[model samples]
Target: MSESAAPGALEQVRTFLNTWWVPNDTRAPEDRLPALLADPAAWQADLPAFAFPGREDAPGMAELRAALRAALGEARPVALGPWLARHPLRAELSADPDRPPLALVPEDGTAGGTILAAVAEAVRAGQWARLKACPDCSWVFYDHSRNGSRRWCVMNPGGSESRGCGSIAKVKAYRERRRITS
Candidate 1:
């Protein structure tokens, strides 16, 4: 998992968006959703909010994942209207006066609804724009920077230097510039 996860419920959206794994191996990168959906325990372990997903729900989950990837990665906007319409969340009043008055709940009690709800919440909090996808590796990461102008994933996550997409892309750009000048 990347250390650049968004704070609060937005972390769930970031986590779901980052499921498309690209390892540092020669083999082609792949989506981890299929394998994750096959195992119910894995679903609970990774996303407890998306609990008890069955094999039948795999297609929907995959579709949602793809739509989200496009929305995060591509220039064109992905119309999530149909999906959001299908999985609607109901507004509930909170018991605690200190807490926010309204809460959104999944009408269908599915993970998709929960994800959509989280997305809505993040948008409400104005943190949705901070979630970004790395151009080099297409990995989703949250920009926790104060200025909110962060465009790449960190080169070092846990203080040790690694070939994260940010450093790799900078190196490639540098090489290209040098090659042009030479």
Candidate 2:
């Protein structure tokens, strides 16, 4: 993993959940989830590769995305408990017994076959949270924080911190106010 990459298994899962699954201005809104599941390579060119320890194919990627979409379509929150109940990653994280403590498996399926497995374990263990789609944008992300108060998409440049859709109206209000003052 790069110096700036997520530090551990949980962090790695958090990063992937938050960053990889979302659509931004560059990628069309409708293409985000499908592109990530069916053809990760399409987005790979733009993103820093995820590095775990033992690398193998992860079936969970597609399964989880499908499940998430189904839940979202139904207007239900994707809960981590139900997700892990269906898909488990324990065996994968333990692929390399000789590797260093907290050694992560690279995500490109090159290392051995442990990265996705570890991610599964983390999700099962509740180390990660079920991410909700942004109210403004349909992007999904893990709420890693304690409060679970996150609501906006990080993939968006302004994200939750800014006014987002509310900004356009705010700008119009300011312009109208200035006109009146003039």
Provide the TM-score for each candidate, comma-separated.
Answer: 0.85, 0.41
Please give, for residues 76-140, the per-residue lDDT of candidate 1 as tens digits. 33376777798888888998986578977778877888887877666667777778877766667
- Model 1 scores a C-alpha lDDT of 0.72
Q: Cα deviation of 10 in candidate 2 (Å)?
A: 6.1
* Per-residue lDDT of model 2, residues 73-125, tens digit only: 12223453554444333322345567444443324443113334545444445
Q: After superposition, how far is residue 1 of candidate 1 from its true place, in Å?
A: 11
Using TM-score as the measure, the top candidate is 1
User: Looking at candidate 2, what is the lDDT of residue 39?
Assistant: 50
TM-score result, candidate 1:
0.85
- Number of clashes in every candidate structure? 0, 14
Task: Specify the highest-lDDT model's number.
Answer: 1
lDDT of 2 at 104: 38
